[model samples]
Target: MITRYDSNNRYSKAVVAGGFVFLAGLTAEDCSLGIEEQTASVLKQIDDYLERAGSSKEKMVSVNIWLTSMSYAGGMNKVWESWVAPGIVPARATVESKLATPDTLIEIMVQAII
Candidate 1:
């Protein structure tokens, strides 16, 4: 069975299937936020959804991150490196893209098993 949450007109923010959770792409709410703040906000959102699905970041198997500018990769990596689960880090990829919102600097999606 599959469960979806935060449904609306546009998209479901998260979904759970079998023993895994898939989080939708998420970006910072405020455009002026820096990479660190944006990363923190995204992670927090992920945590909330994971908790609801009976999982956590440590259980993540994969993660995909998108950035509006590649130039911020270094700074973003710094925060990501610190937030990731120690010793059981998930496979991750970071890419540059023009986000859906003009002010968005970064967006993240995650897949995890409970």
Candidate 2:
């Protein structure tokens, strides 16, 4: 069985199948914010989506994080460190890359179990 959430013509914000939920890359709605603010906002969005998908941060299996530049990683990590509990942290990879927009500082993708 499969399920989709927050779908639009372009793509679903998340898809659930085979007992796992796969989320699309998400960026803060207000990209003009700094890295810490953007990361915090995106983390909140992740929490909301996880709940809607019948999971939580503790269920997250993997996370892929992208930052517009390596310089912003510290600020982003600060926010990430606070939101994620120590033991429940998911397998994650953070990389420097160009984002969808110049203003967008970071983007995150996640996978979680049902």
TM-score of 2: 0.97
**RMSD, every candidate, angstroms:** 1.1, 0.7
Clashing pairs in 1: none
In lDDT terms, which candidate is top? 2
The reply for model 1, stretches above 4 Å from the true place, is none
- Please list all clashing residue pairs in model 2, or write none if there are none: none
The per-prediction tally of clashing pairs is 0, 0
Question: What digit string (tens of lDDT, one per residue) describes model 1 on residues 24-100?
Answer: 99887676888888888888888899999899998999999999999989988898878877898999999999998
| Candidate number with greatest TM-score | 2
lDDT of 2 by residue, 13-92 (tens): 99989999999999998988999999999999999998998989999989999998999988998999999978988899
**Each model's C-alpha lDDT?**
0.89, 0.93
TM-score for all models, in order of appearance: 0.94, 0.97
